[model samples]
Target: MPRPPTMEDVARAAGVSRSTVSRVFQNGGERVSADATVRIHEAAKRLGYVHNLVASGLALRRGRQLGLLIRDATNPAYGHLHAEMNRAVQGVDRQLISVTASRHDYGTAEVEGLNRLIGQRVAGVFVGTGVTAAEDLVETVTATPMMIVGRPNDHPQIESVSYDERTHGRLMADAIAAAGHRRIAVLTAPLLYSRVFDLRMRSLAERCGELGLTTIPVDLLPVEHGVARALDVAREEALSCIVCPVDFVALDLLRAAVARGVRIPEDVSTVGFDGLGDGLDLLGLATVRLPVAEVAREAVTRMEALLVATQEDAEGPPPPGGDQGGVDATARARHLVIPGRFLPGRTLSSAPEHLRT
Candidate 1:
């Protein structure tokens, strides 16, 4: 077999020293001249040289890897979040170690996953899963820096970049009202199941109350079975709409309606959060297109800033007024809520005259 190309080979081809090539790749190209950086990259591409990030971290014996704990990898929302976070981490030239957990359990698997990442000596962890409670996650990671991502979190001690579910819920409710849905059925789940979903339902119901609209609460336990019951309620009570906490649930309801020969938007309107699934327009499902990519990008950016601040604090105070990389780990926690826009599909429209009271 032929010997593989190495950074030394790349340096010789780019007319730079080996150390310069090392600094350019490992330090995110900071401090290196743009021309030199470009030459180094082009030369490496020509030679088919790939950086061995894992080996570099091993040689340094320091945490050069970031960890991500996400829930239900199969779920489209989390799946998209995982892809976006990977892109952001790669942009900074760091390796990402990801862990997945099912939502059915009581977060034991998630806690163990966190420990595994900590055991790998990761510098920081991004908790993007809605499966674990914020308090439990906070308690588990005492040594490693942890940040909440893509989930609702308000712990005074934890910082998070999450979707603005409250605003999303309100926006959805306004849309329903505008469509002449005076009475609706809201599918809900226990808070322990998913705080994100709970917040969505609560905000939608609250906003509906403010609008003087009637809301029928339907418990969605054991999702498949609950969705069937919710459909029944929508039909029996002559509800004008059924609001789902997530797109998957809304899809389930739409499928069930089809099985029962029920017409969507004509018999009863339907709406959901998280516009991630394909064929949404074909299915004519109304939903909110969540800012998954935006949240993922911001979360990784925050994680990078946090890592820099931690390093500075350990190396001694920065010279007075020195930049802390736009993040202060010692400061009180900060929460950022990014909003999503609504998709007015064929599923939600004016209720039938006989059903609209």
Candidate 2:
């Protein structure tokens, strides 16, 4: 009928500080003396004490609990990222709490979700949405150990681990050019809506220009989900290929083409990014698959390092959650770009002879 034995009981029995007991259990007695660790374990066994990692994490605030802010969980890419991040977090014996923001609300939903995570006093936060601007996220985090994930970040004070979208764009462009498509339409949202898509489109356009291919930009409005306007532009311009920034857009275009009874590859070729969607192989949609698992692992690794630095800061002169300036040069903000491989699907083929020129 008695309450379960707690860490305090074990600490008192072992004649050690509460923080020392915490370090012994939380970090496998990394810095605790051997005698203290043995005594703590002996006391825990005698008292039938078990460490509650969840309660410990919450109490520490800056412990092994991290936050993630993702957008559009329904989207295959984000879904894959969320799953991989969870796996990564669990692998390191840490806990992750996530918040989802509206994909269409631009920065408002994302900002609010980010603040919610900050209010939890998590050790650090990972921002995985592309809708919010890097500058806005940086300003919002202030001194929090925040890092950008699955989205491009170039701010000197913000760290990031993102897909190599530029490489993805160039790969798609090269595939389209090799198919002999002289003119292609790029379906993408404006920079304000999604910075990743904007960068991919810009890189695609630049590469297309280098390869002497004519590029036509088809602005995708959020109000319209279908790519009917893009199809019309392709038909009117006699474009031989249409490249989509994401697989979802490509799927929409394919559905639109099917409704219009337009033949794929024969009438025109199409390609998209993010090969994470289901049935991609069955559909044979040419695209690039972002390294979601790798990005997640790397982001978690960077976060762990940041948490360590933050802990050290708390023990030292500077306050915990201090600004970037307090951290050493090597521990300062850095960007890591991971590249993805190309999937040569059936959607991309030789341009129709009539539209080759």
Candidate 3:
């Protein structure tokens, strides 16, 4: 077997200094004279010289790779966002390295993994979800560019891009109220898994106050196979409408309601958030379609800006609290509330005549 060609062999064959070869590969051939670049290419082709980016990045003290840290890829919400984020990263000409931390048991190991990406010198990071305790991660990646998605409250240093859960919640409340739903029950997961749901809760409460609607608070429902429990609660409370945090839950409710001979839109309307793909239509569910694509695009944009800032500050003073700036103020002062449109499917309608009267 023949030994692989090295940079020195290419340099010698091209009749150019090793430094010139390095510069040509490192900073694109356009940086070098066109004649010299042609010579290098010819030599490289003849000698089978492939650029070792790992070694090259080590020599330059920088890696051009970006990290995408997500909670669970299986979650439809994150899955959609991840695809969009992948496309956005490619569109911006950056490579992405993905890591998933278990939603069930996210611990310090996951944090260490994120830090490991930095040790490998990733250019930037996009945190999707499931990272509990971000204070350390935020500090470690202070000099690295990063963006956090779907979290409302901003970290001191990490930039966050998310849909306004509060606005979405308020909208749901208003829609139900407009349809004359007096007794509304909200079914969702525990607070830990329901940050957005919490916001929605607050907004719903506020909106209900304005509309003189009464909201019933029920125990948090398990996301996986909680439809039965939700259905039981709906029946017990005689809810006029049930606002679910996820489409799956709404779908389950529809099934449960059908089994119990409950007429949708006529007996009890249902609304769900996070408009996923098809099949929801077949169930005739009403939902607020989240702007997943747009949210992912904006998150990537924020990540790019943070990366640029990190690179620019590489030689400058220590990053302020090692946190990404701009995101905190913007997130707090004015949440990027992307409005969700109500998909008034066959599931929601005005309350029954008896209830209205």
Each model's C-alpha lDDT? 0.81, 0.81, 0.66
Candidate 3 runs further than 4 Å off: 1-61, 106-113, 130-143, 223-226, 316-337
Candidate 2 residue lDDT tens string, 103-136: 7777898977876775555668999999887766
Stretches of candidate 1 above 4 Å error? 1-62, 317-330
The estimated TM-scores of all candidates read 0.79, 0.79, 0.72
How does residue 99 of candidate 1 score in lDDT?
Answer: 85
If the candidates were sorted by their TM-score against the true structure, best first, what order would they fall in?
A: 2, 1, 3
Per-residue CA lDDT of candidate 1, range 1-357, in tens? Answer: 988787899899999999988876555454667567657766765676755433332123345789998888788899999999999889888989998888677688897788666555577899988868777776575435689998998887678999999999999999999888898999999888998889998999999999999999998887888788888998899888998888898888888889999888788899989998878878878999999889988988888776665555445534356432322333658899999999999999898888778
